[model samples]
Structure formats: structure tokens, C-alpha cells
Target: MATGIPRTKWQSAPHHIQPNGLNSGNTDVHLSYEGKKPELEILNTPPANLRQLWPSNAGHVTPNRLYYGDNLPILAALAQDGSVRGHVRVVYIDPPYATRSVFQSRNQTDAYMDLLEGAHYLEFLRERLILLRALLADDGSIYVHLDDNMVFLVKAVMDEVFGRANFRNWITRKKCNPKNYTRKTFGNVADYILFYTKTENYVWHRPVEPRTEARAAKEYQYVEPGTGRRYKKVPVHAPGVRNGETGKPWRGKNPPPGKHWQYPPRVLDEMDARGEIYWSPTGNPRRKIYFDQSQGVPVQDIWLEYRDAHNQNIEVSGYPTEKNPAMLQRIIEASSNPGDLVLDCFSGSGTTLNMASHTGRRWIGMDNSREAISATLRRFAKGLEPMGNFASKLESAEREEESEDTLSLFGPEETAKPSPAKTDRHHAITDFALIAQEPGADDLADAVGQWLEWKGESRIMQFREETVPYKTGKPQKLHRAKRRKQRR
Candidate 1:
């Protein structure tokens, strides 16, 4: 709990190297539990400080947004200003599950959460969730997609952040078909989506279908009394009586209990003549709701819509990390009506934004990987539809000083050429420890050898470098400073 530099660790140094934000230049650095294995990166920022992460221009109305940086810093930067403060309607993230599977691009393994069981994974979600909660609207929702490995931990964190009363539902998603994982415990066929709302009365729009077959079977199950088409029936009455109208009583034995006719005599007569009315068994008259007429069923917590991207020709772009659009479409439709903004900080493959497009919602997405960002840009560019209202909205909003893109991931410039070679150039590095994944004797020696020759020249022992080996849960790399001299 103690945040200050301890006297033991403080006194060891001449007192000049401590961070100016924490230890005053005069505070002796004494070695303590914190000092023995202190975290180097998490400095200066106070955990208690509530950061206000918001978009810069409030007037920009473009439905698309992509950020290329750490969500933490973005949140921290937002803390100083509340422009985007308290305005988001929904949020979704697919964080690293702490499985510790290092993602590789060119033989360099990126530090990712090891999905194997661990506590650090939970803390990571907890910290990010806390920041995310601050950015939510009063009546907003958050959906976190996680695996069995850390679902419980992530859920507990959300319960604490959003308050237990706001905890909505744990969504059971069919990720991999049971046929594939039949050998594992429980077949490992599904993943979990933890839903949390900011308040009880959050945005609750019922989902309307795109005239899909399943909905056709469900809502359009009944038949019209006259047209003989499958149709759902609705009572055509209100609870209260109206004024100045001849309330039409159809060839009916009075309206349903406590209800009055919805239309006046003339309108009821017209509908009756059109044969849109259905005489109920109770001798009450109702209206025929056409099958081709109704929207989709209200989306539920249990999702079965999206299938993971497997085929390259599936409009999925088959990027290394593409999310199913159906999954996000449901989330967007359920939480926001048309034109409302949705947020996806970990917007890998732009599923959230893509769904926003199909469903007519506005959205913003952000990610740190250049490859992922490029993929998203390419997806949009490939579509090549005229920007239309979405583009006009963006321009008008900017004129009005509204929703502006702060770190515009894409500027006026076109896409850059891909990195020519995907191979690990493995330039000679002096301190191989600086480039190692783990501190194994084998990889460490190999890594150092690469660093030394990292410059393409033969091994050089005294080149100045910037990186110190990170404390990667193993022996830290020890690269004492070397004197740099001019080499002809």
C-alpha cells in the first residue's frame, strides 16, 4: 500500500535517479518490498485520480473512429478534460485472456496476456474496467468478451466497478462448435460475454430483425384472418378513452376488458372493409399485424448469431484477428438506437464499427497494433461506398464543434505499403537479454548475438542502446552501461 520510496532503497543511491513525480530529489531511496521489485512503468499517475477520456471535437459526426495507442494513456489524457466525458452509450472489449500466447509478426513475440490461469490477467481487466466505467453514459452498457480462463475474475471486477446491482447477465456464446473440442472439459465450445449496465434504466431498444428466416418463423407464425398470410394479431385498443371521437365498436360484443377502441368509427369501418381485422374467439375484435411488417425479436443475453471467421472468402477479410460482425450487430442494436455512438477500445478487425454501419449506429474504435488498424482501414476502403450521410454528419459536427476525431487513425493519406519483408531481420544486439522472450539460457545467448549484429555490421560490443531488459517474471537482463566511441 505504501507508494513512496523507502528509506533503505532511497539511501543507497546518491538520491539523483528517482522519479521526480514520486520521490523528491531529496528523499533517500531505501530498499523496501516495493523497491526490491518495483514496477518501472507504472509511475506518477495516481490510481485514485478519475481520468476523463473523451473525444476532442464534439461536433464530428462521422460514424467511424479508430485510435492507435494505449487505452490507459487515452483515458489519462481524457481525465484532464471531460469533452467525451459521460456520453458513451455502450462499450465492448476483447482483452487478452492472459493465456500468455505470445503473438508473433516477424519472429518477435509480442507480450500478451498468457491465457493460462493466472491472477495478473484478472488485475488487467479490473484496471481497464475501472477506467472504462468512468467513460460510460448514465444509462449505458458494457459487454466484455472473455474465455473460461478469466471470466469469473473479470465478472467480479465489473460487479465492483458498475455496482452489483448494475450487473446484467453473463452471456454464453457459441464460439467453437462442440464437435471440435469434444475431448476437452465441457468441450470448450463456448466463450462468455459479461454484460454490465451503468444503471437499471439504461438504453433498452428491442432488436428488429433484418427480415431473417428465424424471425419470419417466430413473429410471422400466425395467419391473417382475411389475407390468409402468416401474421401476428394485436389488440387494437388503448387503456384510456379518447375525446371528441365516435369510438367505433366493430361487430364486437364490447372491447376487451378496461380497453377502448383505438380508432374512431370511420377508421374502424375502413379497416373492417379492408379485411384487416380479426374477430377473436372472445367475441372481441383485434387488428392483424402483418408478417412482412414487424421488426426482429428483442435480442437476449444468450447469443447464437455470430460464427468465428474461418473461410477467407467470407467478407471477413480473414485478418489475423477478425471478430464476427453478427456478434457486434446484436450488441449495438440492443443497447443503442440508430445514430447513437458505440465505443470499442479494443477494436480488433473493426467488428463493432462494421456492425454499427449495417445497423445504422454511430461508432468509434481504437487499437494499438498498426496491422489491425490497417486491416480496418482496408475493410472500409474496400467497401468504397459513398460516405453519404455519415460523412456529412462528420462534417456538420465539426462545424458545430461536436464529435471530432482526436487521434484520427486515418488521415487524408492513403494506406502505406506493407512492411516489405515479414522475416525477423534480427540485427546484431549487444545485450541479447534486451530482446529475449524468457530468460532461458538458450534463447538469451541467441538474442544477445542477434543484438550485437543487429546493425548488419559484425559484432560490436560498445554501441549505445536505449532498452533495458524488462522484468519478464524471470531473471532481469543486466546490461551495464558501455562507453560509445566513434567507429569509422
Candidate 2:
């Protein structure tokens, strides 16, 4: 069970029982029935005993932040904050996919535990999603990446949390090469990303891909003799009957009986005079579409180019389940603008953070594992020194050998104003602080207060108490209670 959340609210509906004769060994059956249902509940609940910290030497503060803890609490804390709430423009989370296996590193060191299965797994994700909804701006969007094991189930959960009407795309990404292991199923090579928006109106930067040589040659089959430029011919008349000017005659020829001119007759004449209309041997006039005028092909949902690192040399951080940076870059560029706030809660290797910074987007990354934090630190350290002209080289606090406790660094007073956007090739110093997780939010707050007393920057450090829990669960239909006859 997740802390600060009651089990009843997460599992309000009666558990559906699996039908007989189904193999109990198969986890797929768990999705069939006998589990908690999704529900939408009260949001705006605050996290208990939350603490905010900064580095004492930081000049200007950047909204980019990284938190070390279970994301539920971190997300709850952000949802309740006035400045951060409903301000995030884009969120991309690749959470544990309920694989029921403990992930380990190449040296056999434990990385993360994904043991929660069945209804427990569903409920756990549901609770956090509710908070995420409140945190998204009205025009913001979220992308949930999932492994094959849980994509279908999680899709249902997403539909319930974000209305089905707001659901965007079910993207299929080629995650790796074909697996050769002998198994009952086909070679697992692809995974899914469920995209959803807070509402019909959301931020969207149309993505374009360069047209391939073959496609370009095929589509632009015509070539202008004078300029030798590739072009295509399209019908100037469209499928519609109109009594307006578009239905009138052009060049002493009337539009086809069931069609209307795409442009006014005079406009068509002007295009013809400018050599923008192609006249076929039969005298049919078609509009000339040039290759140079196109905005490239719109990106599709089926992605095959970006995949996980194939070998150690190609690996960025060597963290387990690290995603491709190109993928993260695409998501950031397409869904968010420069200086927009981006979030990744299950920020395992910090791939999202790295891309977010490089792309000029402010970001917040949260992860609970020490190894994860260490990996993120290592990832940020590489090649950052060369970018010092635009970005300040990141500094990491040494981990104490004996205590092994979380450390909180107070940023400098210069960080109080919005940090300049790191748009140049050089890396500008992005305001960042690392916090150790305390037993309680109040404890963390007390630590912040104590540190502020010595540093004299209490105004910058803020904390919120987690008194009321933000309620969330997958949307599900509940059984109505039977009304009993009142005794006279």
C-alpha cells in the first residue's frame, strides 16, 4: 500500500472474479477480472511534511529541479504548490510496467523492485495519475511509456484518468532488435506510448520528417522544363457542387457537373498566367504543387529509428531501462516549447532531464533509488565542462561514507529570479538542488529551517504539509448498495 493513501479509496469497487478454467499462472488473466477498478477522485490533496531546498551559492534560480523519492509524494507536493500547480506544459513518465521482476545492473547490483502485480499495480499508478492531472496545465499533455506486459491494461487506466475524448495516439516504438530466445510468444521488439491531453485544446508542435528520396521521386513526378524543379499536379476542381463563384466557368470551361473549382475563376486565371497551373494534353488544368513548398511529411506514430543502446560503449549512463535520448528529444520538441516546464517522475537514468536541458526546456526529475541518483549525476557530468560558456558545469555534493544520508544544498540568492534560458551551444548553469529524503515531510521542513537559520535564506526555502491526501484511482463502475426497508 502507498503511504498516506487509504486502500478503500483505491479499490472502491468489488473485485471482479476470474472465470473458471483460465490459467492462473498467466498474469494476463489478472487484467480480465478480480481486481481494483479505475476511478477519478478528489485532487488538490497536499503531500505531508514536504521540504524545499536550494544551494546557498546559486545566483539565479532555475525551475529545473530533481527530487529523490517515490514520485507519489513528490507529485503530490508539486500539485499543492501555487506556482507549480497546473503550470507544467509536458510530462513524460516511463514507470515500472508491473513486470514483477527485480531489475539489476550488469554487476548484479539491485536497481529497482517492480514486484507490485495485478490490482495492486493498477491502483498504485492510478493514485499518482490523479495528481498528475491536477498538475498539468489546461493546454498540457502527458505521454506514458509502457512495456508490452502492461500496455493494454495501462491504456484502460489512462482513458479513465484522462477522458477517452482527450486520448491522442497509441504510438508503437521499436525498442530493440528481435529477441532470439525461444519463447511461446513472437520476438518482442516493440513497446507502446499512450499520449493524452488535459483537454481538446493542448500544446502541439507539429513534427515533420524529411521525405525519403523514393517518396520524393514518386510524389513529385513532374519536372518543370524551364527551372528543372520537381513538382506534382493536383486537380484544380474538388468534389462539391456550389452555386458560388467557385462553381462558375474558368477559361470559357465550366467546372465538372459535380465539382467546384478549388479557387475562384479569376484566381485560377492568375495562377495559369504565372505558370502555376499544368495543362494536360486533353486541356485539363491542374494546379502545380512544388516539392520546395512542402513542410515535410507529418511524423507518424509508428517509430522505428530510436532504440535502446545496443552495447556498453553506446550507453549514456549504463542505468537499467534507460531510454534513447532521441526519443525524449522528439517528445520534448513536439509537445513543449522552449522554456516550458517538463516533468519525468520515474526519471531512471535521467535521459529525459538530459534532453530537456539540451532542448532549452525547464525540467523536474524525481527518482527514489540511490543508484538512480548516482547514475543521473554521472550522466550530467559527461562533456558538461565544454559547455561552460552557456551552461555552468554541474557540481555534485559528495556522498558521506558513513551516513549515506540525503544531502540538501541551498542555492545562492542570485537564483531567486528566473534563470536565463540556456539556448546557446554552451551550457548555462541550471539551478539544481539535491535533497535527502527524511522520515517525514515535517522532518525535511525542519531540516530546511535549520539550514536557513545558518544561511539566512529562509524566504527561498518553502515546505508544504501533507494533511489531506490527493485521492486518485482508475475510473471504474461501482456496485450500488441495496437499500433496506426501514423498521417502524
Candidate 3:
């Protein structure tokens, strides 16, 4: 797994390359795996089948899609399809941490299990990463959430799957407030998210943090007259000596020693003419920066804000390991634009999906756990208001259909076409599709596939009426009982 460039060689170079940071310099260093060929061959094999069960009646309201099943095969199916392959703009996955613990909902419903250990777990995640990489557009980016348990391993896998050159940031996120561990270790309160892009030219809308009161007071101490707006005066010169027009005389004044003008001489003259330049009492010239005109401060990698929801009032989904919506919103906003597709394969409580829908971004979500699916459905249902008492009307319509079915079974005469029940329920925003059993290539059309249409600014997907239960096998009992027994 060693790279072409030796550590000593890189150390002898100018910059100090951090181990956790991006390897930004020199293309000579490349991550190589001895078993890369076999892994690639295994990943290239397509899913056995891509069978679609039914369209979620709820899914049609928005361009979002929810798939129920393992993400590996679902991603493979997406790769096989023409419309979705190389079309996704953003991907955010918060996979199980291999903690070897069983997770349950607040009501003791079995959520998911994280039992795989060591290499097996690594390979399990690597296979999906391979397909995810193929599914991304050239400008797409991915953020993989992980704990300290396996962040380094996954980082290596990501570097190999996605070229090392595409590595972006190792963002450290403060997951919770604090932890008081009984064992001999420090409190674990943080997790890491590895961010990478598919190619050099990637979608990036720089994120910003709101200006704090203290920061605003310190940076913008000056007040402008007539308007009384907060302002700051910054030197018009920058580091590095230059011989260009920026280093030349401005109004017969030369640049300071070992510094060059931030702008050209003509530009400085124009700023002075427009009253943008502040002439100090000591004859020093600086540029005026207004507080309201600033776009806030640029966001950094080490995030202290946007912690996870700890209490009932703070958390919306109550799904175990559910992420904060604001965090997801930031990732979506920074990495994608309106109408672009966002993907969350391990969508637990649909936090990413909810954020994507609210922000006008199309999304696709997949999960194998039945509890996860139910949570997501309930979340979306509450968030979406049906037109009128449409729920009651739909129930009534369904009851009538049942009655008609009974009548048709008893009569031998030809059955008439049932009239379409129409309400103001016009445009749909989301579509739900299920991949039951693995089908062959011939079943592509019959399988669940989503088709989208735009109504003004909102895009809707056509949903078919169908439901296929997820096959998650037997549910595990909660560990609460065991802990209670031990207390006795």
C-alpha cells in the first residue's frame, strides 16, 4: 500500500505534508494496492436483478426517490441504468461504525446491526464505494462519515478508489457535547468525515459562517457618517514584492517595502474617485470594508457548531444516529445546486432527504432496515401536507375499490374501467420505489424505474401503487433488558 514517493523524499521538499491532510503536491505519489485488480473485478460484476415492486403513492409528490434494500446492489442497479449513472451531484453516507453493537429505535424496534469485524467490514464498505464512484458525475463530490474506529482505514480505501489527487478535506466534526467513559480513555465526542471529489473540476459553493457579535465588533470598529454603518479599513498593499503595475506608483506614491499594491494603479485611482479609499491622518491609504457588504467568514474544517441533537425537543427524527439537518443542508448547499441530484444510500431517518427536498434539490435514498424505511415514510408524510382532506378521500376511494373487486369476482360480465379519482393533488415531489429480489437484465423496464416531469419550478416523479416489505430477517431484542438484569 506504499506510494511511489518516499517519506524521506517528501520531507526533504519545501512544505510539510501532513498525514491527515490532502496530498496536494507532486503527482508522483500514488496509492497502489496489491489486490486492486481482484477487487475491481468483483466490483464490476452487476447485480443479479433490478426488480421494482411498486411506486410509493407518497413518492410522486417530489423528485426524491427512496429505495429499500442493501445499498451495494441498489448502487449497482443505478450504475447499470443510463439516466442515473454519472448523474449524481452529491453523495453523503453515514455507515455503521463496526462497533459490533445492535441499534434500536426509541420504542425498542430493531434498527440495524454493526457486527462485521476488521477486514470483512472494510471490504463490505469498499465494494459500495466503487459503485458510488462510478455513479458520480465528473463534478460530483462525496462525504463519508466515520468514527475514530475506522476513519483511517476508510480514508485509505477512498484514496485508492478515488484517485489520491481528488482528496479534498478530512473534516473533524464535534458529534456531541461530551462523554464520560468508564474505561481508561478520554471522552469521545468527535467524528471524522472524509470529503473527496470525482475529478479536479468539481462543484463547490464555498460555505460561510455568520459573523458573531464579538468578531463584528473587533473587525469593524470604524463607523461611516451619514449612513452610520460599521466599517473596517484594510491596507491596500499585500505581501510579496512585484515589478508589475501593482508595484508602481499610485498618485506618485510607491508601494511599501517588500509589498505590492493589492490592485492596479488605475484601479486604485478609480477607488479613490469613488470614495472607496480611506486616507488616514498619517497619509496612509487603505480600503473601506462595510459589514453589511461582507459574505461572512469562510468555513473551516474543524467544526464546533452544528452538533447532533441530544434532547427530544432538539431532535426531529429520533432515529438512532440521525444527523443534524443543518449539517446536511450545509453539505448540500456547498456541493450542489438546485435541481441537482443528491444521494444518501445509508439514509437512516431521511435527514439528508428532508434537507434536499426543502432546499429544492432532487434526492435518492436507500436503506435495508424496515424501521429506517418506516421512520423515513413518517417523516416525509408529516412534512408534506396533502391537498385538502386528501388522506380521508384516498381511504374512501380505496374502500370503494375493494367493494368493486368483490363485485367483479362474483359477476362474470366484463368489468368497466374505474373512473379516475382526481383531487387538487396534482404535482408530486417524491417517488418511492422498491427493489425486492435481484432480477436479470431483461427485467430492467418492468423493474421499478423513476420518470420525472417539471411543473414550473418543482419537479415531480410518477409513482406507481406498490409495496414490497424489506427482508431484514428476524429482529434483535434490545440490550436494555440485559442491562436491567445486570443491575439486579
**For this target, which candidate reaches the highest TM-score against the unseen true structure?**
3
Tell me each candidate's TM-score.
0.52, 0.69, 0.71
Q: What is the C-alpha lDDT profile of model 3 across 282-327, one tens digit per residue? A: 8889999999999999899976665664311243454678876778
Model 2 clash tally, residue pairs: 33
TM-score of 2: 0.69
For each candidate in turn, give its C-alpha RMSD to the true structure in angstroms: 21.2, 16.1, 17.2
Q: What is candidate 3's TM-score against the reference?
A: 0.71
Best by lDDT: 3
What is the C-alpha local distance difference test score of candidate 3?
A: 0.68
Q: State, as a TM-score between 0 and 1, how close model 1 is to the true structure.
A: 0.52
- Please state the error at residue 263 of candidate 3 in Å: 0.7
Instruction: Tell me the deviation in Å of residue 94 in model 2.
Output: 0.5
Instruction: Give the per-residue lDDT of model 2 (tens digit) for 1-488.
Output: 23343333354654664675334664422234454543434354445332233343323245677676678767776775665678889999999998888886443456798898877887788777888888899999999999878788888877778888898999998776443453798667688999999999998998887776778899999889989989999889886577899988888788887678999988988998989999889888999999988888888998766666431114445567877776888899998999998989899868798889888898888887766765665556441221112221231122122123322221231111111122224342334654434443343444345444544455444344211112112221111112232222
Indicate whether candidate 1 or candidate 3 has the larger lDDT. 3
Error of 2 at 297 (Å): 1.8
> Which consecutive 10 residues in model 1 have the weakest lDDT in total?
429-438
